[model samples]
Target: MDTHTAATRYIGPTGMDPIFNRIANWLPKLGIDVAGGRLLAVRGRKSGEWRTTLVNVLTTDDGNRYLVAPRGHTQWVRNLRVAGAGEIRLGRKVEAFTATEVADADKIPVLRAYLDRWGWEVGRFFEGVTQDATDAELADIAPGFPVFRLA
Candidate 1:
């Protein structure tokens, strides 16, 4: 299944996505870091204006940084697809990078590592899969979770 089809079939935004996004967006503006979270700004594919959201930035053991869409194909994910690049800001510090979507097949380790660090906050979105889940298990849900590598 393609990413869009797979995403629509699984999870979308939750009731709390907006509530938490608002709070998360506010924190970084005040110089508060919520577990490595930052404000991601990408230009809207249609509107051409920058859209912002609070996102969890995951850094793996190999020093690569990633952004995972635990909420499936969200607006930010769709926007990033068109923009191809964006900025992540924490307080006044902003880091800009090009974004490359990680294929569903290659998302295993990235998803696992993301779960390991942010599972306490986002585990429920994975439908009971944990960081300890086997490769096969991660693969089953891979299509539903869109991942990106920041360059």
Candidate 2:
């Protein structure tokens, strides 16, 4: 298979593939944070399935934590929304928090931060939307895309 397909296979279902999970589990020790700030565990919106996604952790100037899904329309994003809350595991500490979608204007800085962390591939994904689209508009395009803050 081509590289993209191979990568997709590895990241299958939010990097749940066995090998991917192993690597994901080890990444932090190596000093690379995969999901941005923390690892989140959420239930699937429609299937009632449980999933773990490593998302970028966003912090405001005032210190509140946020998680933004550039592809907000994805299933996991919806799941977090419907479920209203999820668990964030940072190293050995795990905490439960509510998830909220941030406004578009608010999302811009978060998206910028995400781009800074993940770079072009992520930035390009959000760039595809119109310049005028609200953060929510761009966010809505990808149902799984979301900006999650702590409860």
Best TM-score among the predictions, by candidate number: 1
Q: Taking the tens digit of each residue's C-alpha lDDT, what string does model 2 give over 1-151?
A: 3334322221223534567656675654344655454577787777777777666666767787777665435556668879988887766677788877775446565655555666544555554554445656544443334577777
Model 2 quality (TM-score): 0.61
* Superposed model 2: Cα runs more than 4 Å off: 1-22, 25-37, 47-49, 127-145
lDDT of 1 by residue, 1-151 (tens): 4556676744655688768767778998787997888899999999999898888999888899999998788889999999999999888988999999999899999999999999999898887999999999898889889899999
Cα miss at 40, model 1 (Å)? 0.6
**Best prediction by lDDT:** 1
Please report how far candidate 1 places residue 111 from its true position, in Å. Answer: 0.5
Instruction: Give all candidates' CA lDDT scores.
Output: 0.88, 0.60
